[model samples]
Target: MRHTKLGRTDIDVSQICLGTMTWGSQNTQDEAFAQMDYALDHGVNFFDTAELYPTTPLSAETYTLTESIIGNWIATGGKRDKIVLATKIAGSGRPYIREGQPITAKAVHQAVDASLARLKTDYIDLFQIHWPNRGHYHFRQAWNYDPTKQDRSTAVSDMAEKLEALGECVKAGKIRAIGLSNETTWGTQKFLSLAEERGLPRVATVQNEYNLLYRTHDLDMAELSYHEDVGLLAYSPLAGGILSGKYLDGRKPAGSRGTINGDIGGRLAPQQQAPTQAYVDLAHAHGIDPSALAIAFCLTRPFMAAAIIGATTMEQLKVNIGAADIVLSDEILKEIARIHRDYPMPI
Candidate 1:
């Protein structure tokens, strides 16, 4: 597996960061262990999970189950040092988490400590905020993303408080680096500015959804990544299995993400089918798995630090991990560009 320095930091991570959102829900403990062991054996050293995981059926009851499952693996086999652990503290979506509170100093400190306890580790390699407390355009919110309602002064103040708390965690040796998820270009810049001014831990990465169907991070985010040194940890590189052509023609396989989450949090829009088909056809024409095509494309991006991938079964895991070495030719990339122009933002 290919590896790179995470953002401007000295820490090195694999190009394919194993995503663990389906564990403890779609999969069992033994399955998660198998996936982790296989990933580590294959030199995939980075893994990404979140407090709000097993997300197809995200509920208060399933909260922390995924992290607890990883904790079980670490507690049993003692494979902690074999991987770089990255997880997030959820923000403002579930009532059970801090009563659906915003990110603040008290909230951040409390969240990190709880995560450490659950992961059975003394310190996390990278800790991230699942989303900004104020709001963002991710998760198909761009159509009605009205930032005018958000108070800028209040948001900046909250960021400052959270940075202070993160700084304390760094000093206490509880977390090595900090990151953001589901955040916008503006939010990332603001957090970095505050960290620089306040002597807090620098934001090293931003995990967001990036795939063949969704290219939101290609421009503004790419610019921020190049200039500010905060590269993207691209999630959903297969577009929640849409690029695999499995969900096309209304064929929802049993136990798939589309079957469970129903369009993947509004990602399956009314106009998404044609573009999905085009990409799948392109993958077939080149004699490769559609899923691998999508993931390999993510690895080719200039600002992609890592492509986060998940699987409910071992076969899916191998298919994603295999993309690390499959470099798409310029002919394929040019064809992809033509498809993108013909149908942009199909989701």
Candidate 2:
């Protein structure tokens, strides 16, 4: 697997990050352990998880269970030193976690300690804020997202406090690097500027949804990533498996994400159908697995640090990790671009 320096940090991570959001929910502990073992053995060293995981059907009962599973795996296999582990603390919106409170200095310290205990690790390679408290256009919120209602001064103040807290975590050896997820260009710029001015923890990466169907990151965020040296940890490179054509013609395979979660995060809308079919057809025409083609397309981007791939089955995991090695030829790339022009933002 190809590797890259995480943002401007000296830490190196695999270009393909193993995503573990289904553990302990859709998958059993043994299944998660086997997936982790196979991923690490196959050259995938980076793994991404969140405190609010097993999100296929998120619930209070399954809260933090995924982390516990990973902790168990690390403790049993003793492979903690061999992996670059990354996880996130959820922001406001979930009542079960911290009573739906916004991220704060005290919350940062508390979360770091709690995650450390649950992960059974001394330090997190990359600890990220799952989303902004002020909220941004992610997870199908772009259509009606209105930023004018936000209080800028308050938001900046909150960011300053969070940075100070994260800086303390760095000092305490709880976390090595900090990142952002589901954030906007303006928010990222604010974090970067604050880190420089106050000697706070620098924003090393931005984890956002980036796939052929979702190209919102290709505009201002892409430029920011290039100039600021903040790499993108692209999530949903397969568009919740839409790019795989499994959901075409309204067919839901058994145990698929769509079958479990009815709409797959509002991704089963009518607009995405033609574009999805086009990409899938293009992949087949070139004798490539549609899933691999979608993921490989992500790695080709100039600012992509890693493409986060998740799987419910071992077979799916193998296909996703194998995508790291499938280099798309120029002919295939141009064909992809042509398809993109035909349907830029279907999702």
Clash statistics: count for each candidate? 0, 0
TM-score of each: 0.98, 0.99
Relative to the unseen true structure, what is the C-alpha lDDT of residue 271 in candidate 2, on a scale of 0 to 100?
Answer: 91
Clashing pairs in 1: none
Q: Which 10-residue span in candidate 2 carries the lowest summed lDDT?
A: 107-116
What local lDDT does model 1 show for residue 45?
A: 94
lDDT by residue (32-139, candidate 2, tens digit) is: 999999999999999999898989889999989999899999989999999999999899888999999999988888888888888999999999999999989999
lDDT of each candidate versus the true structure? 0.91, 0.93
lDDT of 1 by residue, 1-347 (tens): 88998877888999999999999889999999999999999989999998888786888888899999999999998999888999998898689988987877888888898899889999999999999989999888999999998997798898888888888998999999999999999999999999888777899999999998899999899999999999899999988888888888888899999888987888776677898888889999999899999999999998999999999989999999999989899999999999999988887
Clashing pairs in 2: none
Model 2 gets an lDDT of 0.93
